[model samples]
Target: VKRFVHISVTNPDIDSPFAYFKGKAIMEQTLIGSGLSYAIIRPTLIFGKEDILINNIAWILKRFPVYAVFGDGEYRVQPVYAGDLAKLAVELSKTSENIICDAVGPETYTFRRLVTLIKNRVGSSAKIVNTNPKMAFLISKILNLLVRDVVVTREEIYGLMADTIVSNEKPRCSTSFSNWLEKNADLLGTNYVSELNRHFKKINEDAGYRISG
Candidate 1:
């Protein structure tokens, strides 16, 4: 039998305030009830070649003159490289038994440190500054209007302020976000693309906006 492999987020429980997280928990339940041997891989803040979060941060830094940090910015995050997670997914799919594990990178970085790493690695000229969550939201909204793109979403601001992206257990992957950023510096922020445009808006060859990853 071909092993069933599922990818999920780290925390997907009913108690989660976020609707997406709760829905993921329900999705996991459905998968488990399928009675098929499966492996579930949960990753915390995945980072890799042209990833949404990491690359978007670079995109903002590239275009903007300022970057805002919510509060003290001590929140932690463990990022798994997409390549490492894909490799692990293949390995887990090869196994027959039901399994669930967190896929995280070996290193942990605080929010401020994460921003700093991206800025330094990408050679951003944007001035990084600490601001209250409220002010950050206002600034982002203004930026969104000016840029004609969703500079930052309200949910993203909440997620960042909540600082719920880190994993407590040991990481299963060896890829480092800092190293990967250094290596891919040339292509990280070549353009600022929206998620909707990437997944949609280009169903046909000439329908609308062309999507890229």
Candidate 2:
């Protein structure tokens, strides 16, 4: 029997209010009930050469002198490397057992610490400011208008604050976030990556891509 590999989130629940979590849960259920030998890979934050969140954070840090931290920023995140995740997926794909694993890195950092690390790695002189979620979301919305891209979403804020992106399971990936950041700091946020332009428009038209409904 051919095995099916599904990439999912850290904590997925059918009753989750956030569409991301809820949708992932629904898909997991659909796949599990499909009677196929399946392996579910639930990764926390995935960071690499082409990641959005970390790169965007670096981008904002490079441009803005002030960086906003929603709430106290005590939330924790466990980021797994994209290469490690791919290797795990490939290894599991060759198996016939029904398994579920959390693909997480070796280190866990508080939100504040994570941002500070990135700031240092990018050599940014930005000041980190703690603000309420509402204010942060508003700022992100304004940035969305300015950049013509979804900078961040309210759901993303909620999920981050709720600490839903961290996993308690044994770390399954070996890459260190700090090491990766140090090596890629120069190339991290030199250019802003637009999700809409990458997905909705042609790659060649990125220079003048216009968002349309």
Candidate 3:
């Protein structure tokens, strides 16, 4: 039996920060209609080694403290670790059935707190501020118009309000954020330029691969 497992988030609505989430919801809907044994896992804000979003944001905020929050910094989030989510996905893959699971961290933290952790990591005494959704929307709209990219918007802030706290359901595995941080402490604030260079070097060693630039 082939089981299709999906890792999704709480907000798949159009008013999401990332347009990709709505696409994910569409995929999930299509899968359900396709009569296949599948499992959908909606994980919360995931933070771990090599995490693009959480880690990058933390790095930026820690280094540059001029970032503003969407609201009053009261929104709660359950930041899961990537490794834990992978373990659960693997376990689910072993079975062939349609199941919807919400993967989340053990603790609920506010958006401000999340940034604070990053601030501490980067050793940048950056301060976090709060802003209204409308103001954010205006700023983002103007910026998008000028820069040809919508970096931040109101709908995105609304989406953030839809926290990913796992309801009263048993998580297949539980990896606390602190534990994840501890285990991946070495990768907390490293530049990783060497890692990228190593990847290119390996690629160059492959047959018929050439760097034309």
Q: What TM-score, computed on C-alpha atoms, does each candidate reach?
A: 0.88, 0.94, 0.71
Error of 2 at 24 (Å): 0.6
- Between prediction 1 and prediction 3, the one with superior lDDT is 1
Candidate 1 on 144-163: residue-level lDDT in tens?
A: 66545566666666665565
lDDT of 1: 0.80
* Number of the candidate with higher TM-score, 2 or 3: 2
Q: What is the lDDT of residue 79 in candidate 2?
A: 89
Q: What does candidate 2's lDDT look like per residue over 1-213, in tens digits?
A: 578899999999999989999999999999999999999999999999989889989999999999999999999999899999999999999988999899999999999999999999999999999999999999999889877898888999998999999998999999999999999999988988887766777754666755652
Off by over 4 Å in 3: 11-21, 134-154, 164-168, 182-186, 189-213
Model 2 spans > 4 angstroms off: 202-213
Error of 1 at 63 (Å): 2.6
From the highest TM-score down, the ranking of the candidates is 2, 1, 3
Pitting candidate 2 against candidate 3, the one with the higher lDDT is 2
